[model samples]
Target chain A: MSASTIIFYILSAIIVGGGLLAVTARKIFRAAVFLLFSLIGIAGLYFYMNYEFLGAVQIVVYVGGIIVLIIFSILLTAESGSDMKKPALSRILFSALATIFACALTLWLIKQHTFHVNESTIIEPSVRNIGRQMLSTTEHGYILPFEVVSILLLAAMIGCIVIAIKIKPKT
Target chain B: MVITGVCLLAFLVVLCFFLGYMERKVAAFMEIRLGPNRVGPKGSMQIVADTVKLLFKEGLTPDGADKFLFNLAPFIVVITSMLVVAPIAYARDFQLWDINIGVLYVSSISSMAVIGILMAGWSSSNKYSLIGAMRSGAQIVSYELSIGLSLISIVILSGSLQLSEIIESQANGWWIFKGHIPVIISFVIFIIASTAEINRAPFDLTEAEQELTGGFHTEYAGMKFAMFLLSEYINLFVVSAIAATIFLGGWMPFHIGGLDAFNHIMDYIPSSIWFFGKTFLIIFIIMWFRWTFPRLRIDQLLNLEWKYLLPISMVNILLVTAMAIMGWHF
Candidate 1:
């Protein structure tokens, strides 16, 4: 096999293994760390595909932002050395069934669609092009969705502030 | 690629050693005391002796500590710092990777250092380490936003995320000079935020010695501790180099629109020299701040970022965006 293909296999192994460990790890902190590895592996996949911006975003948003927050909460709320409570047998069985169904459905969907490799139409995903498309007013532009996402984030921020702030008791 | 990587690693070790010595001298000068005179030529060999001592010392893994993570954390921290050097242009035509999203990559990779710090803290099985790591996590996370926003202003001004292109855009003049008020504001904010992000003095609440006692790496010993110290200096260099690159212009020598003779004279300096000179200048400024300012209280530190730097940077981005669109910048 070619080096690129070997690298791809290794990355996939990391992703899958990390995901498995994240769920099965006895300690919560270790589980979070496993999730971090899984996320980083996904970022590696993005890099492998030459999606540099997307890869960086994956690292910045998920690995740097979300996972750190998750770990912070874990550290604050849980004892690091303690083992997590095992899920009930019924819950495990149901989850296993759900996973199988999801995997089968995904495979079926992939088989139904034929992906065309149109070399001529493939544009270099440079930052300049990304920026132009993001803010462009034309039909293909993502300005509307971009603005919508911003508004959604703003609302979330306000909600978080509201929830976090404690009113002082009357003297 | 392998050769360059090896060379860069070697250079970084030497640079870190020099910085260690420099920090001591700077600290000594500020405190009106002689520092490191016992070693080679006014304590110039102090860091070397210290490194040797650390190498010979044992790296202790405490009882009940998470051994796996404790061993892994220093490597993670060191590797993240090393990774950020990839996109940095040391001189004209002297960059390792001129990736399109260079700035983004630097910010993202640098952010990963906090994970290592967190790992170090959590795995140490010490309360002080845990508290220090948590403080570091909160501080780095909050300051990262301001750093991103400040960098966004430069991206808007340069109209490219590529480092080489950004430097080229500053050929006529540096952004701090060309982009005027907004750029200056962002520059100041970048310096302050980056210093805090790197956990330097005034913002070194992560390892606040008085309270936390060595902070996240409290339980570390020997070469493992050295790795943490090395990473800190490397981070200091990285942030200072970034500040130099974005604000002062990477390897571009000073030039003026209507001053041909002066511009020609400035170009006489080598591109690499220009780059290092600017970087070291910023590094000195950071070191100066370390000596000058008192360590900030945790609440005060959080308040400075969220309430002050964050808002100013957000507004600065808008101003920079307007300037970029209006073709106002030189």
Candidate 2:
């Protein structure tokens, strides 16, 4: 197998395992930690894809910002302070069945579809090229989306500030 | 070196462990004391012994804690730092992947560390850890903006987001001496924000031992505690490396325009030595901040970010952009 394929397989395993653990773990905090691993695995995949900027952004925004907020909210809440329950056999069976069904559907689709196999060489995934494309006016240009992300972030910031404000203690 | 490609991760882990040893040794000297002298020559094996002790220590889960998140918190804190080992070119040809979005990728991935801390704090079912996580949640996000803004100046000036290219832009002359005032301001903001971003001293309310009783990881134990400690040091190295690369010119020989002898001496050493020497020096400064300064209150920290860093960095970016367009900076 090619080195890229090996890296892809390894990263996929990690991401899937982490995701599974995040949802399935009995302790709510361990699940959060598992989510972190899953996020890191996604970042690793982005690195392999040669989208280094995207990968860093993935780390900064999702891992650094959003997850931190989630943790803060979790910590602030008193109700979910304890682990609720362990997974039941029926629940596990149903989830397992769903996963298998999804896997089979993906496999069937893969067998039927024929994608354009580019018999081309690999290209350097550099930021300069991305910057150029981002600025271009054509359909592939992502300049609009890039600017829009800032606005979305601003909204989130406002929302967080509002939610985080504590009610004044009554006199 | 035939086994180099396959064992890259292993080497990184060992090297990081070695760095842990170095950090303590240096810290000891800085504080004017003998450190870890009982172990192998010069106390070298102490970290190993310590590692073993931690590994075997009893791991406990608080009775009221959310068990899953508590277990995952340290892992989240650690794994995020571990995975970001990519993109950095330690030497001429030693990079995990030279991804195009190098700068932004590092920023985003590193941010995940906060998530783990948050999980740990919230799930611990302890009031102290919860507040610690809450403080950290705000602390990291606020400082991130200025850090990104500071980095943007370099990205704009060098006109490339790739770490290598940023380093290459400095080959002619370091960005510090590129005679860009705006860049300098951004660099200043970057340092302050980064210090805060990592929740280091003056900004380390997350782990204020006295106030929060060890902050977000109050409930962590054994190997999990060790992971939190290791991840912090690694992150210190990572942030310092980025600073060295962006502001100080990573792996580039220092040249004072035409100081041939100094430039030649710089060239004699391998690039990795230069890169690491610069990185460690900055790490020392950050550690110094940790040891010397007092932690800021949560409100003060927030005010500092919004009222000061964010506005200043935004203005700095605009100034640098104008300078770039006018060809004012060399």
Evaluated with TM-score, which candidate comes out highest?
A: 1
The local lDDT score (0 to 100) that residue A110 gets in candidate 2 is 97
Error of 1 at B257 (Å): 2.6
- DockQ scores for all predicted structures: 0.84, 0.55
TM-score between model 1 and native:
0.96
Candidate 2's C-alpha runs over 4 A off are A1-61, A82-126, A138-146, A149-170, B1-45
Q: How many backbone clashes does every candidate have?
A: 1, 33
Q: Write the per-residue lDDT of candidate 2 for residues B101-184, one digit (tens) a residue.
A: 678777777776777777788778788988888888888877888888899888888888778888898987889889468877
Each prediction's TM-score against the native? 0.96, 0.80
Q: Write candidate 1's Cα lDDT for B220-319 as tens digits.
A: 9999999999999999999999999999999999988899999999999999999999999999999999999989999999999999999999888999
Model 2, residue B119: displacement in angstroms? 2.1
